[model samples]
Target: MGFNMALLALRNDFKKWSFILWIVIIALSVYVFANWGAQGKIGQPTSVIASVDGDEILFKEYVE
Candidate 1:
C-alpha cells in the first residue's frame, strides 16, 4: 500500500514537470516564429519617392 502511494506521488510530480516543460517549449517556438516573420526582406528598400536638399521622402512616409 505504501509503495502504491509513493508511485502515485511520483506520477503527479512527473505530470506537473511535463506540463511546465511543454509550456516553455511552445512559448519559445512562438517567439522564434514571430521574430523571423517580422524580418520581411534582407535588403529591400522601403523605397524613396523624392528628395529635397539631402532629406529623402520614403514611400511609406507618402502613404502615411
Candidate 2:
C-alpha cells in the first residue's frame, strides 16, 4: 500500500495500531541492540572496559 494510505489505515484503527506499533518498536529495538556493537556508533561509555579470552580488553570490536 502507499505511504499515506498505510498511515491513514492506522489512524482509523487505533486500537489495533496501538498493539502493532508496540510490536514494531520492540522488534526494531531488538534488531538495533543485536547489531549495536557492530554498527551502532554513538553515546557515551565512561569506563569502556571489558574482558575476553581471560584477558582485559578495551576499545571496541576486539583488538582487531
Instruction: Give candidate 1's error at residue 60 in angstroms.
Output: 28
TM-score (C-alpha) between model 1 and the true structure: 0.60
lDDT for model 1, please.
0.75
Candidate 2 lDDT, tens digit per residue, 3-26?
A: 999999878899788989999999
* lDDT against true structure, model 2: 0.73
TM-score of each model, in listed order: 0.60, 0.39
Off by over 4 Å in 2: 1-12, 38-64
